[model samples]
Target chain A: MKKLINKPEDVLADALKGVAAAHPELRVDHQHRVIYRAEPKADGKVALISGGGSGHEPLHGGFVGPGMLDAACCGEVFTSPTPDQMVGATTVVDRGAGVLHIVKNYTGDVMNFEMAGELVADSGVRVETIVTDDDVAVEDSTWTAGRRGVGVTVLLEKIVGAAAEEGQDLDAVLALSRRVNGQGRSMGMALTSCTVPAAGKPTFELPEDQMEMGVGIHGEPGRHRVPIAGAAEIAERLVEPVLADLQFGGSPGIVMLSGLGGTPLLELYLLFGEVAPLLEKAGVQVVRSLVGNYITSLDMAGASLTVLKADDELVRLWDAPVRTAGLRWGV
Target chain B: MKKLINKPEDVLADALKGVAAAHPELRVDHQHRVIYRAEPKADGKVALISGGGSGHEPLHGGFVGPGMLDAACCGEVFTSPTPDQMVGATTVVDRGAGVLHIVKNYTGDVMNFEMAGELVADSGVRVETIVTDDDVAVEDSTWTAGRRGVGVTVLLEKIVGAAAEEGQDLDAVLALSRRVNGQGRSMGMALTSCTVPAAGKPTFELPEDQMEMGVGIHGEPGRHRVPIAGAAEIAERLVEPVLADLQFGGSPGIVMLSGLGGTPLLELYLLFGEVAPLLEKAGVQVVRSLVGNYITSLDMAGASLTVLKADDELVRLWDAPVRTAGLRWGV
Candidate 1:
């Protein structure tokens, strides 16, 4: 695989420096490997924080802003950020109200963030967390660290971040975040495998005419491999399981058809076109929809689908304004 | 260049059906190629709307929710959606306050959305628009339609969506959206070209050792091609121009370092690592930062960086709560 970097070993350090230079509002604690909003949130606002392996961009870090996370701890390319890094983020962003850690359901992520949360809690800062187990792949996949936190992490951050921004207590924010996670389900597929910079090769080999279905974001093997089909068939492979897992037909829902980094918007939209009608046929009403590369795998050519059931209140909350580097709406 | 469609012609239609099925809350007006929130916004709320080609998924459509766009028009892959589709979306979502159209800077996207706005205005609906021209790539280049909208569109949608969800007047929303576009700039680099399914080939060929800089999201050629460099060098290539274009020093700003589809998160984070300190050394304070794949090329292996200068008001709005499929925060 071809790559752009001076040395593979220096990739992480070099990229962090570039990020700090490009974004003046973000402060990089290079020593701790954390990226945060330069100006911390107002005192008393519950700080929402998250982190994980370095591969998922705009995720734990891109999301650091006023309406989203207070700080993000980043690990080295697909490696979990060290516990020390998470502790540093939690300590820096904590403004007294408390801190909530939004952890994806990966073993390393969970372990690292949990350790950080504990370390911070020991310092008497309130720290609460919600683990996002949205990917319906498998609890113990051969390729992934575990059932990876795929798409729903985006939803959880936004929802929980909104709660924290509203000055909600830590427990309330944690509850709402957990609720959103509980109600959401996601599944992914990969057309082509990605090569980790460190691994220096495709994480997994996919045949030219086949796709890995139910793949996790971290280059994990999916539930099955099938002959690559049209956008219509691919949509079925991604959406059917999501619907079946959550029974989205009974109520209004919010659906996210996300690209796994390498898929084109054309194909994603085409997939949406195919997925939309089938949802309606199934008696589901999509109150809202989002398509893009929200939570992504490095450069894997694929997409993932996530569904969230919404009541009137959640819908109202959904409509609220927010400003963040990655997601800004209603501002 | 390998794709899975049964027939190239069936891509769009088949995909829409699948979208409708997976996301029941969103209704896909197949005839019009519009994806709308199943439930319209309250009466008198300015309807926020956006559209472009189908390839940039979860964009105009995925953003349709309470705090974001009320509806989105989708065109064929990499091609702008038709005026009729935009017309339909504007008409159905309009609640008397007016409609705001968020268009990217591409010529086709601008022209199509403009035509749709005209059609809607003819029908007696008040419409306003903001065209995002954030990509710093040269305009009217050999391979590009124009400076591609790139990453700033995501920021515009969220900020403008927040204003509209607050029941701000159409003019207010339009102004805010435009302000975001004006304050932001983006530049991208590609390691490998993507294959548009219809084209069934890479958009462009780059020698394995070379990379394309200042590339656009639609597989457009970039400003220059050079032998691939290390993460630090690549970071400098992407960041220098952005910093030169705007004065990021003195005041805090928002920075978005996004992957153009195929770049891995590990590389992305490494890129951020290189960027963070550069901004700090320049005496720029980063108020917010985001690193990820929001806007993308089909499957091009590259990344982009976007910088937006933010003020107190923008920062406050950024802190507002939002709930949507793509962006949810401050719940």
Candidate 2:
């Protein structure tokens, strides 16, 4: 319960205030709880919108800016945003081209975004949905009906957002989003459970010497609990499943090793050091690598790995200039 | 201790391997444990070199890149790097224009860097040193004789690194580093103690209901322990002393709110939402602000704030393009 918050009820609202205060390039709609770029939307450019719970930061909200998300509908911590919030964001960000809703595979998020797309359809905005289910950890989880969408969502947003930003049509952007999602796989482990602000305690109890391998972003039960192993073994457990899930070889792969909130960069780098060699041995030529806390669960000491098979087009798009609170480069 | 490490003794070396694996832009010398820019040293460009205990990540190692430090000498966790490591890095990065050694005010670090500077002098590489002591926490503490150097070192590196990159002579870069250090002030608080890898336990005991105010970076004793308060009150506690120590008004300022490793970004943003207004109310106009984990203790749950008064030139230098693992923007 040791958190830097005034009250559990106000965490999201107050954090949005902080986001607004920290980044002027971002515009926060306090009423709808959606974060948008402050700059005016370009005519006929495809808009990318995504959101889920509030705990995984720098994901949807922090990604809203130039060359990334057009708007992010933020819900309460580990709670789905209301359809009203999503539709409100869709209506505002819709340009002549169309809108793309980058939905994670969580049941609540998928349903809400789907409802919002239907609600926006009457206005003639061609809203397309791309659900990311890239986590190879589980087929079904506590909050998701399929494999949970985890780190690949961060990668998808960057690659597809770049495509959308370059004035690609909605259909092309949707296809690219699907290709990115299909080619990517993720797996996660938790050294500690994340404490939701409202819950005020850790979501689950993990003994001092144990870890939850293949854990979900919302503290969902993983494949199993096991004795905490060294970084090398942990990297093996994460990478083996991801490589088995797909043939990541024969293409330039973009790899991201993200910290789940509480882990330090020193450790993330240490883990990534082990991960890179494993992926290389498996024949995945890592053309680009990101090792840090990009998408994170609140105060969960763990790490997740995402490997995306990329072609030259996707790599080029990822290399494009992006100006967001999270994932800023080449700008 | 629960950390993503193989062995406590090899954490630094393993993490360096990860640093080398993840970032192709920086070259790591495994033997000397120095992270240097992969590109050759620009002819006559003043080189910036910094190092200290390893736990405060992205401080020295993560800042080594094109527009930042020419090299970073990494030490073992919470242990200052040796004189040989510093001298080795100095010899490699020296380009005949002289070198600037950015040292934090810890006794071990100061002494080691001094010896290394003297060792390099016989080799005819002109070396200038700048010691940053911006912590307003205490006049003197366990590891420091004056104020403990804390968050300002990150800001100093960025500003002064840009100066050196743009061909500023050693004297000019040294003077700018001193100016940044003098103008900046920081105060930190810890919700929990960081566990050093070799120690195999939390550095210090902190109760669930209490927090350490004005805490040092290495889990050293702070001013006092206080009942864990609301974010607003905590922001007031951190900001009041920084403002009282200096007049941050009358000039534009660069403010950075860095999370000590364990605190999540959701809370950091919530904390920054509270911190921004207090700085404004105190007449410090925040021209540019960074709200994330820049400098960190291994896994301590807390944050530190650094406010630096900046003029037009400093802001311009701060905005310069820099590419590194920890901080990347405008490139």
Candidate 3:
């Protein structure tokens, strides 16, 4: 495998070191494998924390900053973080206001965050959890029991993080998180499979002329493999299911077309060129659009589409200042 | 080639459609193929215009926005933009103050931009040209007489763009641009070759167990092919030549490690983790660092590092707000 890494086992540890070195504003807890903002939020503001397996970058760790996540519990590649790490982050970031755990709807992640919340309950810390499951690709996947959370998790964190930074209570943040989760829908396909560092080879074998539609982030089997087609047709495939799954029509919406690690940014924009028109034809009015690699699988050449039906409040919060390595603006 | 494009011939036009569709803040002239700030700069502020072949995305076009570039003329993939396109952009973006044409050191680009400057001289728009040759890879290569202008172009645009935005005159902005180019040095390597759309195949052959060090942005031959090694060893290989060519110790520097389109963000961070310490040990104090795909070669699996020795002025300008599709912060 051609990868810029020293050892497979050291991937997460070494990458965290790089993250700490690159972003001085972020504080990395080496021992616990948690990333935190150097400065804590205000006393009455709700603190946010999220975590998952490592490979999908700029997700939990890169999002740790003032306006997004307070702390991110990082696990090994494609593996869940331990409850102890989550407990440590919850207790540390919590102020007089409560803490919110923004988790994707994966079985291991949900279970671990739930366990951590219970473990921290005796410490007199109020922790509320909002699980996101916006992936319309599949109802159940390799590691998930229900819909797997995908790109909407990034949107939810940005919008809800803004609400929390503006001094919203935990209950209000939780409600907003759910609303964003419910309104957002995502569908992804892969032109190629990602090679997990430990695995040392591609997760799955896709023929040169074939692709996996409705694929999961972890290379889980998609709806089916089909002959590779033009970008316009692929955009229709990704957008049709997402619109069918969620009622995104006749309202202002936020759209994100994220690259799946190995795809070029030029192609992502090309795909979005096709995606935006399709969404509009279906009656979704896109107000804010992000076309880049916000959340990505490791070295997988593909793209995903997420459409979030937003009202004025969601749009305003998304427009608020955010200072994170992954997503930064208005600050 | 398995790119997210409809036809190889239609890549640039289709991607431009996406660029216009995704970013409402930027105005794309489909006919002239120029991306400009939707709202032009004020009359007295000097304007910055940059353009190059298309494959290396987020380079010229993505850098066009406030506090950065006033316009970017896009060419076909890896092909120089026409002289007429450059002439049109120079005349359109020239506020009462002069215009700065930021051209990379490729032969076709340099010649075309120079011709365009001469063509617009009669139009009465004062234009000053700055050709960047910051690659420390080789003294001269296939398409370049001196060094190939690589990642430093991105840094030059950001630092100098801020100067132009703050009302620096054409002469002052041109001086700053030259200073940035002179102080910055870059070295790149590739694990796999990028596939140009029209070529319908990999640009060059890279064996499974070897890598090309000092590789050019367009898959041009590098210094040599070496056995693939660990990240730390590769980091040492990239940093040694850069430090040897220039004295970078004892000053604050802005460092950027850009992916060549195909490497994962996890690996980029991991590689930066290895790169940061090597520079520090060499006495280059990295006051600021950017790790992502700012400049890219379609889908080559590798990275390039650019280090700019910066003083107080350059550092302050670098910290100023920049809001572009590729790089956005401090706003």
Candidate 4:
């Protein structure tokens, strides 16, 4: 594979080194592969930690900083981190107010985070877990037991992290995280497949003449393969199912057209241009929209759409000042 | 081309519609094809306007907001916007203070912006131009007369835009823009060629076994085609020329590893991880670093590095709170 990497085995470790160098605001635990805020918030404030496979960047690691994730336990490419790593991260980031494990609905990730929570239970730091299953693409994939969590994890971390920053109790942060997860729905399609570093090949074979609809972030199979079509038709196809799956109307909402890693930012905007009008016609009032790569399938060429039905609280928290390597604004 | 676009001709216009829908904080003049800050600063505040072909996104259009740019005129894919469009943008964004035209050093862009400046000069508004030719990849490419203005334009816009937002007169802002351009150097390589919508095919043929070294953002030829190497080797190839060409060592500097559209952020970080130590070994002190897709060729797989030697004044201006769709923090 002609990737910009040295060796498959060294990709995660080398990238973490880059992260430590690029962002001095974050401190990297090289041994455990955890990224923590250099100076975490005050005591009694809820701490947020989320992670998955390493390929979906800026997700868990890049989100660690003020007003977002306090720590991120990174795994190898598409592999969940060990429970020991998660426990180490939880112990390091947790203050008296407890820690929240914001995890995607992956079977391995869910199991590992749960095991880590059990390991940390007697350490005087209460640990609660909120699993995000916002992807409506499939009921379950090879790696996931249920619907996979995709883009909503990024939005949820920001909104819930803001509430945590306001000194909310762990239970309240968990409540807000679950609420955000409940309101968000995401669907993704891939024009091309991503190559896992270890596999040395694309996760799945995608024909040049077609695309995989409802693809997962780990390069998992989508709903089905379909002939390639124009962006407007594709935007309609992606949004129609989302509108049907969720009651996103009757309230101001947040719409995101996130690029699936390989697609250029130019086409992401073009897709959002096509997707926005279709949503409005379907009675969705989009108060805020983010169009870029947030959560991504590594080098998969296409896009995903997430529509979150936002109330005043979610909107306010989303607008709150957040300082992170991935998403930063309003500060 | 399998891009998410309806029609090649409609891509720019359709993307502009999406820009309007995504960022209500920025206003879109559909008739003039310009993106303007929804509400500009007070009278006597200098205005910044930069534009190029549409494929390199978030360069000029996404930078329009409170602190960065007052207006951005967009051209078609890889085609310069006409002098008339630039004139229209200049007339609208210019307060009594003056307007600074930040033009890339492409032949068409420089020529068109010059013509527009002459038009705006007769309209009783002063217009000074700063053309950034920071790319060290090629001396003269097909579209450029000298080194192409690549990623440094983004840095220049932010530093100069902050100066303008602080109500600096046109001359001071012009000086800062030129200074940033002079202190910056950039070089890029593409793993794959970008497909322009109108071309409906890849702009250039790139074999899988090799990469285009020193590739331009518009898919222009690089210094040479080289055998594909690892990220570390590629980083050295891109960074070495930049270091040899300029004195970037012994000072705090801004280093950005920008994706040329198709490369994933994960790979960008991996490349940066490989690039940082070499820079440090060369005695360059990186005070700040930005790793993401800032400037891009349409769906080309590769990355470019831009190093801007920063002084205390430049660092202060860089850290100043600026709000834009592409880069936002400290605001």
Candidate 5:
């Protein structure tokens, strides 16, 4: 219950105000809750847009800028953005090349983004949507019918945003987005449940001596609870499933060890130490590894591993200069 | 305490291993516990070195890279690094141009860095030191003689590091560091106490309905305990003292609303929203503002606000491209 928020009901709006205050480079649509670049890209360029809940910050909203999403629709805590908000963001950011909706595979998000896409089409703008379902945690969790999208969305936005910034057509950008999504796999665990601001308590009760093995970003029950383990063992649980699901050894891999909000970077670094050697043992050639909180579950003390099988093209795009608030490098 | 550590003693080593694994751009000296740039700067460059307790990550360690500290000495959690570690790091990174020790104003840190400077001088390497005492929480707190160096050290490192990268002499860099320290002030509050792994419990008891106002980064008791307030009121508490101590108006400013580890970005942004306008109304022109978990007190749910009065030269240095884990831009 000890969170740095005003009223639970006012979290999103207040945070957006902070976002606007901190990053004057971004234009905050206070009414629709969309974050757009202060200057939209020139005409005849692909525009990228993404969003889900507000809790996984630096994800959809923080990723908006040059070489990333042109705009990000911000929803409420653990809730999808409404079609109206998506449409408003799309209209503001779209150029002649059209807009792409990068929706994570959450039922509420998917359904809403689809409806938004159709609505945008009625406005005479072309829209392509890519649904990313890279989380290997569970097939069906508390909020989704399939694998829940997790960390891959951050990587995909960076790489695909680079493609869009390079004047790639909507088709090419969409193709690259889908490729990165398919090549990336993520697995996460939670030390404690994140208390949704609206909930006023932890989303779920996790015993003091145990952890959720494969928790979702929104506190969805993971595979099961297990007794709390050290960073080394926790690394095994996070990396094993992602490696099993994806063959990362044959190609250069882009890996990320992202904190689930509440975990400090000190511990996240410790987790990466446990996870990296195991990936190397499996013959995974990690060309680029990112360790920090990029995508997060609000105030959840745990870390997640994302392994993206990268070829030269993907690595090149990933290396391109990105100026977003969350992940910025090579610029 | 449910933390991702093998043992309290091993946390620093394990996290350093992870730092090596995740950041190939940086080199790790295991035995001495130092993080240095993988490629040292050419000889005859003013080298910047910083170290403190390991808990406030990305502070001293994460800032080591191209345009920041040449090497960062890593200490145990909440414990200042030993003089031996600092001496060893100084020996390795001391180009002919000498090294600058950026020490925070903690009793242990200041004393140890002073000892290390003398030891480094014994090796015939020129050394300059600057002590940052920007925290306005209390004139004299648990481990500080004056104001505790809370968040201003981060800004000082970046601005002064950039000056060093441009090959500023030790005297010039030292002067700039002093200027930054004099112009900046910070105040922080804690929603809850951080639990040190070694202690296996919260540092202190904080009731669910109260907050520690003006809390130090190391969970040192702030000026007083206050009833929990809204982000607007909390922002006022953090911003008022900083502005009162330093006149930030009439010139460009660099403001950072840094999370104390455990808080999420959503809330940090919300807090920033509440803080920015108040500063503006008070006549502060925040030319650059960074909001995130840059300096943290491991898993402590709170935040600190730093306002550094900057001039044209400092603003230019602040905008320079620097590659470090915590802060980066304008490459």
Candidate 6:
């Protein structure tokens, strides 16, 4: 329950200051809680923007760069960024090419980004958006917000960022992003509940001998809580649901095994070990795989699995070069 | 100091099994501890491969996908993957386009991948390699293995992956990766030390009121340890070294404020708040920025700052679309 922050209310503001000071390249919009590439986009390049609650580090913000997003609005921990913040980001990063807002499927995130997009459009800037609902953990229904966008957001930003970088039209970027969401799925489990600083205690009680399966990134209870089993068993619990939800058997796929913050690489690798054979046995060929803490829940001891079924075009785009702070490739 | 693993020896194997099961698309080379896309690389595509100690999740493994890496070799927790494992991965993923080995600058990781590259080359496979030495925390010299390739490795893999995906020749990919390494720098801090399962205790001790600055990803001692300060002070301590180590002022640059596992997103954002302004005031334009737990140390509670001086081309690539499990964008 102990933390190193000064007055709880001052935590977010103070952290923004630190980010600005630490990296000479970035600028913090303190009044708006927006972290942007200090440099604006090219005169005619469409600007890509995304944002959400603050708890997921290296997410909306980490993805800001040329091949990804131009600006990211950060909200409070587990709370979506306000409309005003999004508006500022959109206005700042907007180029003649318009702006594409990558909104996660969280209720708060969707609401806020939607409002900002509307406002920016009203201001004469063309605003287009694609909401990511890659998490298959929740049942999609008319009554619900739908599945949360867990790990696939990272992939969306990188791939779409590439398209935007190639000077692809806004429609092209949006189409590519939608295609990514259509093909990707994610499911997560939490071995131990995370203690939100504000909550100052475990968000949910998970017995030492048990884990919450199909958990959401924001500490929401999962579909089931089961006895903590071996890595192989846990891997099965996490992956089976995903495979059933999507068919990967007839084609090649890209998979991501992500830690939910607190889980160590030791367990992650063990989980990966358990996952490999089962996948081979399933007759599904994984064309690409990623394992680690990419999308995380603040120090929560758990992991998530994401799979993206790839076609020839998706695979080619996947192999493009990027140069963002969080994901850089091909130099 | 507690974990959910069954037996110490079974950690890696058990985890890999879980990975295989969860990600049906990924094929696990259980015998060799390698994870690859279920589908082999296309003919004439230069295969990209990377691996290292097991604890650094999502590094070599999470990066195995289109636009990043073709295969990742997982070693025992905190231990380097063996030469044989890397050899297996390289041979399997390599196409006639040749294979590019992206090795972090860790002593063991470099040696193992180097050995594998040599072995693959002996078999008549064209191979190119680049060692990322982006950690500014350690001195690069004969006395040491060199700066650990902490956060920058993720950037390297993505950029290189994209280039390889674009079918840029092997030499191009290698050159681009090296360029990224030369332009990027990282420095990290640890608030709490992680207990490597094998070590069975905290890797290093920090008083409850103190934080370790310039800590490496593998629990290596930092440049200094001081009483835990407000997020503002902590951000300064982490970023000052990175700025001092390189010149980020001339052109726009990319910045990543990454958490060393166990640090909550709340703390990370607070740190970012403090970091953003300092950079702006210093006249360094941040063209892109990322904040999150990218490269981590088990559950160590700390963060690192990475700066990549970027140009229009790199920035454009930074915005490219990617579809990996760890990072996805555009769709």
On residues B109-214, what C-alpha lDDT tens digit does candidate 1 reach at each position? 7888888878888889999988788877777754336566768888777777777777789888878888888888888888888777688878788897788888
User: Model 6: runs farther than 4 Å from truth?
Assistant: A2-4, A21-27, A38-40, A140-144, B1-6, B12-193, B198-229, B232-260, B264-297, B303-331
DockQ per candidate: 0.30, 0.89, 0.89, 0.81, 0.87, 0.26
Runs of candidate 2 exceeding 4 Å displacement: none
TM-score of model 6 relative to the true fold?
Answer: 0.66
Tell me the deviation in Å of residue B206 in model 3: 0.7
- lDDT per residue for candidate 4 within A1-331, as digits (tens), equals 7688889899999898889889999999999999999984688888899988898887889898888999999999889998999999999887888999999999999999999999899777799999999999899888888899889999999999999998899889999998999999999999999988889888888887898899889888889999999899899889988988988777788888899888988788888988988888888888989998888888889999999989998999989888898889877
Alpha-carbon runs more than 4 Å astray in model 4: none
Docking class of 1: acceptable
Report chain B TM per candidate: 0.93, 0.99, 0.99, 0.98, 0.99, 0.95
The digit string of per-residue lDDT tens for model 2 on B1-331 reads 7899999999999999999989898899999999999986679999999999999987889999988899999999999999999999999899999999999999999999999999999999999999999999999999999999989999999999899989999889988998999999999999999999999989899999999999999999999999999999999999999999998887888999999999999999999999999898888888899999999999999999999998999999999988887778878
Candidate 4 lDDT, B1-331, residue by residue in tens: 6778888889989888889889999899987789998874688898889998888887889898877888898999999999999999888887888889999999999999999999888879889999999999888889888889989999999899888888788778988888999999999998988888898889899888899989998988999998999988998998899999998878788899999888888888889998888888888888889999899998989999999999999988889988899999778
Question: Across residues A194-290, which tens digit of lDDT does each residue of candidate 6 receive?
Answer: 7676776778888767878888888887788887776667778877888888777867777777777677665766677667667667866667666
Each candidate's fnat, listed in order, reads 0.52, 0.88, 0.86, 0.79, 0.91, 0.51
The residue-by-residue lDDT of candidate 5 on A1-331, one tens digit each, is 8888889999999999889888878899899999999974699889999998899988889999889999998889889999999898888877878999999999999999999999989888999999999999898888888898889999999999999988999889888888999999999999998998888988888999999988888888889899999888999999899988977776788999899999999999998999889988998887898888888999999888899999999999999999888878877
For candidate 4, what is the lDDT? Answer: 0.89
Candidate 3 regions exceeding 4 Å error are none
lDDT of each residue in B1-331, candidate 3, tens digit only: 7889899999999999999999999999999999999974688999899999999998989999998999999999999999999999988988879999999999999999999999999989999999999998988999999999999999999999999988899999999999999999999999999999999999899999999999999999999999999999999999999999999989898999999999989999999999999999999999999999999999999999999999999999999999999889988
- The 10-residue segment with the lowest total lDDT in model 1 chain B: B139-148
> Which residue pairs collide, candidate 2?
none
Candidate 1 matches the true fold with a TM-score of 0.71
lDDT of each: 0.75, 0.93, 0.93, 0.89, 0.90, 0.76
Query: Model 6, range B10-88, lDDT digits (tens) per residue?
Result: 7777767766665665788889889898865678888988888776665666666666778888888778889998888
